[model samples]
Target: MESLKYHRLQQRLGYTFVDQKNLQLALTHRSHGATNNERLEFLGDSILNFVIGEALFKKFPEAKEGQLSRLRSQMVKGETLAHLAREFAFGECLVLGEGEMKSGGHRRDSILADTVEAIIGAIYLEAGLDSCRDRLHSWYAERLAALSLETTVKDAKTRLQEHLQSLQKPLPEYNIVDVNGEAHAQLFTVECKIATLSQSATAQASSRREAEKQAAAAVLARLGL
Candidate 1:
């Protein structure tokens, strides 16, 4: 029944599934399958990276390799995938076991993103690269446009530094004023001072970089940077 629903999803794409199991596998969460979409997600992740990378490479022919990679990364990020899932309403058909269903597994970033990758993987396997490229771009066209507007996905700190540098202002500084939370999920409170306006944010992550990103996003919001 779940497989049929996923096939219906493919039909909605106006693309029939070459391998029904692949699409089914894509839809299966770890909580549901003895083995799950993680492996498929891994393959799909690479496929998407390559596909999105190539797309950007051609679209922005003058962009350097690093810039292209950053743009692709931004596009393939979990948040982007989750957004795609929402756009396709894939969550509505996600077949979660009882536990995951109760825990909001269908809407979770990890689940939704992985499912997206798996679906892409299934698409690639079924319809080949041309079809994959076509379908993927239909989703990514807007994202590509938005990315073209942004200078880079270089994060708020970079943007802030660049902004100050362009204006000949001193570099912004991030001071870890406080740290909170248990060992597993620590939150770092960072204060970013840019000229006379001081802004701060707390980022919670499993690692420092993650925390910094969270903090930077906050600082950007606070400073309107």
Candidate 2:
């Protein structure tokens, strides 16, 4: 039954493994056992960076280094990867421990994202670099094709700060509204306050920086900028 499920997942992923065990290992979470996907996640992370970097370089020949870097970061970030995982129904295929399973670990963005990377590493090991690159391109096809120079612009926080500076208005301030969850996987809630704006904007994420960015994005949206 497990093999059948894995086979279905492989069909969805558009890649078959020569050594099926590698694929199984890729889907196994750390909480499942000592021998889990962490090593594969590390390996896959390096391969992903290189594959995406090369694709960006060729796709945007006229783009500068900073622009390419931003594009690559957006492409491989946890949010995007988690989005892809959902599209692939990766949550159905994960092997998590009793604790994680009860807590809905498969639905967690971080876990889903890490499993995607671990699968990438497994693909490379079972097949080869070219095979891994081809699979990555296939998975990221629509996203890569949609890239534009405008998408490489600075993040919301930087843009908001610059907009305020241009008008000589007081800079935006970010305050931690709340922090929840365990120490290792904390969720930070941030409130962005601008003196010019009457109301504060709030957002939450797994990290302080990401929470701040989310809050800034909300503030920007509220300000209609």
Best by TM-score: 2
Clashes of each: 0, 0
Write down the lDDT that model 1 would get.
0.74
Candidate 2 per-residue C-alpha lDDT over 1-225 given as tens digits, one digit per residue, 9 for 90 to 100: 888888888898999888888988999999888889999999999999999999999999999999999999899999999999999899999999888898899999989999999999998888889998999999999999999999997889989999999999999999999999865368999999998889999999988999999999999998899
lDDT of 1 by residue, 146-166 (tens): 777255668766776777788
Runs with alpha carbons beyond 4 Å of true place in candidate 2: 168-175, 193-200
- Residue 133, candidate 1: alpha-carbon lDDT: 83
In candidate 1, residue 171 scores what lDDT? Answer: 76
TM-score of each: 0.73, 0.86
| Cα-based lDDT for every prediction | 0.74, 0.92
Whole-structure CA lDDT of model 2: 0.92
